[model samples]
Target: MLALFAVSLLWAFSFGLIKGELTGIPPALVAFIRLGFCFILFMPLALMAKKYRPNLRLVLLGSIQFGVMYLAYIASYQYLPGYLVAVFTIFTPLYVMLFDALLTKRFNAVLLLPVLLSILATAIIVFKMPDSGQVLTGFAILQLANLAFAFGQVAYKHYSVTLDSPHKVNMASMYLGAMLLTALAALPQTIGSDIVISQRQWAVLVYLGLIASGLGFFLWNLGARQVSAPLLAIMNNAYVPLAVLLALTLFNENADITRLAVGGGLIIISLYWAQQITQRLENKVD
Candidate 1:
């Protein structure tokens, strides 16, 4: 849980960085560079580990989680406004719970309460109705991204428990998979394009690639492995309000302080409620 919170805080600045610094860059190119950094950071460690080999499952999981999710998410911006994208992302918590239930073949109705609360809280902070006539294409694309991300978290949490190797070893295979997918997606975008990156953009990309995408994801998955599905679901949205708050303060973006306070308070309550429910469940099992 601490890992999750830490990653949330770490990721809070990413929104501002991307929106502020990396605006003209192609999304696939950005994703490729980021995942490339992840691969570079983890692959060597994996190779040095004794008796290490690639895990196909982790590769596939990474492809879906990081690769597909990034592509789909970036593509959605073509059809939807940024605010709509944020609004649509609030559904991710529900998708997380749904995927977990489906994969585990156990649905605890009690856990749904916190998940719903988290969604409601996030919606309060970010939700805005679309003024455009048709946004179904973007909505579908964003949902696909959400589903991929949600499934990846649930699947990795369930699958990582059976692994005997260190998580970083497996992360190498995952990043490799992501790198391949994003590289393929970015190929056409970069070919014959006079893509000039400023020094500042390069620095931002490096930070996003190394710290946010690499370390942040590693910690988030580590935290996911330690928590229940419901808690994991709730934690999915925990960063939304924080990101908004950071944008308001640091980036000079205007936001409703009252909404932030109210929604943020509800998010905290949902987290507390989830912790209590999780403890009770563990006690029952014990």
Candidate 2:
């Protein structure tokens, strides 16, 4: 959970960078560059894991989680407002629990409360009915992204638990998979476009790729390995309010301070409630 919260802080600044600095850049290229940087930064360190032997299944899983998921997330913006995108993401916690249960063959009805609280809290913060004709299309696109992300989280958590390999090794190989797919997807768009990135944009990409994608994801997945799926799901929503607060502070964006405060408080409360209930259930089992 702490790992996820750390990534939330790292990612909060990213919203402003993408909106302010890299607004006109092609989404695919942006995705590609981010993964490319991650791959470059970690591939060398991955060599230390050469003795562990790379798993093909894990690599493919990483491709889906990081590569395809990013593609869908970046594409959804074409049809949805930023708020709608954020609102749509509230469903991700539910998806995480559902997918985690399905994959692991264990069901916990109690997980629903945390998921519900997360959605409600996030909805309070970001919900606004879209007036656009393509609202449904955008919602669908965002859900696809959400499911992909949820699936990845569950899959990686399950996979990592079974492995004796180091986290850095797995991250290095996983990022390689992401880089390959993103590069392939972005190549056509980047080849001909005269998308000349200014120095400022380049700097933004470097920060996003190095700090955000590289370190942020490493810490998040590391945290995922330690927490329950419900906790992971709740923490997933942490970025919403954090991003909103950061936007207000750094970008001078107008937001409901009261709503932000209340919503964030609810999320924190939801986390605590989840931990308590989960501990009680574990004790019962023991």
Candidate 3:
């Protein structure tokens, strides 16, 4: 849970960071650079670890989760506001629940209440909607990205449990997978565009890749292992309030503090309610 909270803070700043710093950079290029940096940062430790063993399936999963998802996620910024990207991510918890149930073949209808609450909370925070075709496209793209990320999280939790491997070693492979896929995706842009980066952009990419993507992802997933599936799903929305707050403070974006406070409180209540429901259901089964 601490891991989730930590990553939520770490990831919350990212929307503003990318919008403020990396907006001029091609989104695909930004993604590729970040993934490359992440892979490089983990490679040395992965190589030195005596127990490191390559898992092809995990590599594939990570590619979908981080690599392809990053492509869609970063590109959406070209069409949509960063805050909306964060807002659309409210659906991720629902996707997480759905994917978990589909994979494990155990459906929990009660989880939907929390999922709906999460979305409603986000809607409260975002009182107005953009009725634009481009914004709609961005939302669609963001949802695809959300679904891919959620699938990866649930899949990794299920797969990583039996492994004795360290998270670093596993992450090394995952980041490498992201690097490869993003590299391929970025090739045309790399070849065609004479991309140049200011030192600030480079620094931001490094921070995002190393700190946010690298440590944040590892810790978030590690925390997932310690909690129930429903709880883990709820934690996915922990970033919503933090991101909104950061956007307001850092970007001077217009945000209603009252809405943020109320929405955030509702989100917490939803989590507690979901946990209680989960516990009662388990006790009934037992």
Each candidate: what lDDT? 0.91, 0.86, 0.84
Q: Over the stretch 1-286, how does candidate 1's per-residue lDDT look in tens digits?
A: 9999999988888977777688789989988999999999988899999988889989999999999999999899889988888889889989888988888898888999988999999999988789865589899999999999999888999999999989899888889999999999999999999998899999998999999999999999999999988889988899999999999889999898888899999999999998899899989999
lDDT of 3 by residue, 220-283 (tens): 8788777778888888888878888988888788789999999999888988888899889889
- Backbone clashes in candidate 3 total 0
Ordered from best to worst TM-score, the candidate numbers read 1, 2, 3
Residue 38 error, candidate 3, Å: 1.4
Across 175-212, the per-residue lDDT of candidate 2 in tens digits comes to: 88888898899989888779889999899899999899
Model 1 compared with the native: what TM-score?
0.97
Worst 10 residues of 3 by lDDT: 124-133
- How many pairs of residues collide in each model? 0, 0, 0
Clashes of 2: 0
Query: How accurate locally is residue 268 in candidate 3, as Cα lDDT from 0 to 100?
Result: 89
Q: Which residue ranges in model 3 land beyond 4 Å of their true spot?
A: none
Report residue 16 deviation for candidate 1 (angstroms).
Answer: 1.0
Return model 3's CA RMSD, one decimal.
1.6
Better of 1 and 3 by TM-score: 1
Candidate 1 backbone clash number: 0
* Model 3 whole-model lDDT (C-alpha atoms): 0.84
